[model samples]
Target: MNAHPLAPIPDADVDAFWRDGVICLRGLFDADWIEHMRAAVEDDLAHPGPLAREYATQAGQRFLGDIGAWAVKPGLRKYVEESPAAEIAARMLRSRKVNFLYDQLFVKEPGTAAVTPWHQDGPYWPVQGDQILSIWLALDDVTVQSSGVEYIKGSHRWGREFRPIHFGGDTEAYKMLPGETLPDIDAIRREPGSGGLEIVNWDMKAGDCLLHHSMTVHGAPGNASSTQRRRAYATRWTGDDVVYAPRNGQASITIDKPTIQPGEPIDCAVFPRLWPRPQDSSLA
Candidate 1:
């Protein structure tokens, strides 16, 4: 395990988040919350739901994935929007109103070569503005060799439209433009605490959460660990001033119909407000 930084989330973290578009919050969830979430994931895996899809895998090791409203499962609904995780999100977004965007579970089996493509979460989403955020909660120990998530700091500010890619394979989908260079993951891995243009991979435990902005550039490599499985629960949220935007050529199964246009309010039934943490309240 890497030595804990052990510093309060300073203005720099929030500044980095606003400037760079991503930040990591360590040990955010307690033991009970982690266990409950773990149990929920196991139950979802065992009793495969209708939404389960063979998550576009590369080799024989297939990953089970699901989407849409998580409220169907009592455990998932309670944990996704009402847990300590939500509180952290609320504080970060600095908005009293919090909503559930969606929840996804990615469990990479040992020997899986399927790689998640580098992309921003905002474009595929049907929301507008910079109020969106995603919380990636690790349910197991994640290491660089185990296909942990990699992020390009401040890449969220990079202005580019979302591009579709074929998941799990090395094809034209993973290809970059002729002159565009992919950020060096090796250099970031080597300089752990050197600072300046650093790439961060949190040596995360079961209860750690990484809060990322909508436009942050992030992707993970193939799982190389022999026996360890990487399980994650990804919860998305939005704050005030965010609206819905419809993008052409993008398809999302979670939404029934487009209620939010490119510049409309995201007050739809799908993204219902979860917590309105009152301002000046002792809780705040």
Candidate 2:
């Protein structure tokens, strides 16, 4: 229920997501939902679940994050199930049926400086196909200088896969997934013209979100600002083409004993169906 008269997402934005692999929406989430998500994040920070990890050092201060929190937090579950995010994902992916993948929480206290390595989400997870994307919702005012998720324009269309770098900077991703790949991002950024790669990011408010493709090249800079704290939640969604492809790669650890196979459609209690909301035109 868009009770706060949010701005309608433009058709152009949907097309942009399909073509460019990333799109940002403004004022899509209402105030109450933002507050609820913020509270939920605070709860998560206090009580991180099994997959939670404080990246780097928590001794003085550091970036704290975790994934698959919908199972642990009731408010987050309600937000994921009842909010407009699923519908928005369906519209962006041009999918009639969508599946809930998982929710990732990222919080950076003021003056925390830890750069997120440039990587794509698809190769890191076991899911297959291009119908999956993540909706990153911000609960605090985010600036490029503070905490911003940047994207490489049209990187999704490149049709190339790369190794995923762990945020902790210890594990070598290329060793896990062996393959010949493009040059390192640090190398690419140094080259002249960078082979048409264009990195972009936007200053976002509490209610703003970016729906980015699974294969899109993205990474966020650390919170360098002295007084700005960044709080955000990223909800991953999948469409009809996504399946339980545990063969090609390691399926998301959040999922346990999946009942499906590589080529089969992924539909289990863990990865619940989200879209095709029942019609309710009646006024109560």
Candidate 3:
């Protein structure tokens, strides 16, 4: 197969993304796209369908929710299935084939004190390997005070599996292994740029995005900023080589009774290929 020669992914950026397992892409989507997605999010919030309960939180509080493609609001269909976002994921994975792992919305309400536990996205996911990628798009400005994402540099290479926790709130019920609590938040704050730990708070505009590998260790503190609302749309994708692997103790949410056995190809519709760069075209 001929490799499509698209615009070169910046060497520095690619190296950082591969080494640390995350890369922040500034102003990737334009204002129009951002507005469109924002509208979709609003619609979902207003009408919130069946899957809405999965994402719903108490009124006047921050929460995390997911609406599967089939259950997504009509306004979000195009963005969920085929959008500039999916195209970017396809390119980043360097795969002619791509799959939709899922779409999630992370909302940090003003004064919300919930913190996301430090964990790798891969452990919770059914797919294995480094084929997975996650795109986090901010719907509103994200600042450090508002509790934006902070990643552990090069933690993807740690190669040790940390316990998976509930995505929405802190809990020890899902801790599959003996895991240590993350170091003091205040200490982490003191050494923001120390020890090769490149902590990033984009304080991003609506269209800015952060792409990270599935194995990258990341977490966000509570939203303390009273001014800005920290809302984000996160989409995950997998490349050609990813396969289903049922964890011994974990329950599967997206799959039914584990159709994908360990070491089996992930051929389910939930994760369908979305894009393939033009092979013979001259777009590059």
The estimated TM-scores of all candidates read 0.80, 0.91, 0.81
- Which RMSD does model 3 reach against the true structure? 4.8
> Per-residue error at 280 for model 2, in Å?
9.8
Tens-place lDDT per residue, model 3, 1-284, is: 11222234566876677877888787556566678777777776666545443322456675656445333466565665645666677677776687777776666777777776667787776667677899998888887778789887777887666667676554765666444454443466577457446565556777678999987888887788877777788888888888877666564444224455679777666665566634553421
Task: Give residue 142's error in model 1 in angstroms.
Answer: 0.4
Using TM-score as the measure, name the better of candidate 1 and candidate 3. 3
Model 1 Cα lDDT, one tens digit per residue, 72-179: 677777776556655566667877777777777777877777677676777666677777898888888998677789887877776754554445443463244221
**Clash count list over all predictions:** 4, 0, 1
lDDT of 2 at 107: 89
Better of 1 and 3 by lDDT: 1
Provide the lDDT at 155 for model 3: 76
Instruction: Return the candidate ranking by TM-score, descending.
Output: 2, 3, 1
Model 1 vs. true fold: TM: 0.80
Which candidate has the top score in TM-score? 2
| Whole-model lDDT, model 3 | 0.68
Locate the minimum summed-lDDT window of 10 residues in model 2.
247-256
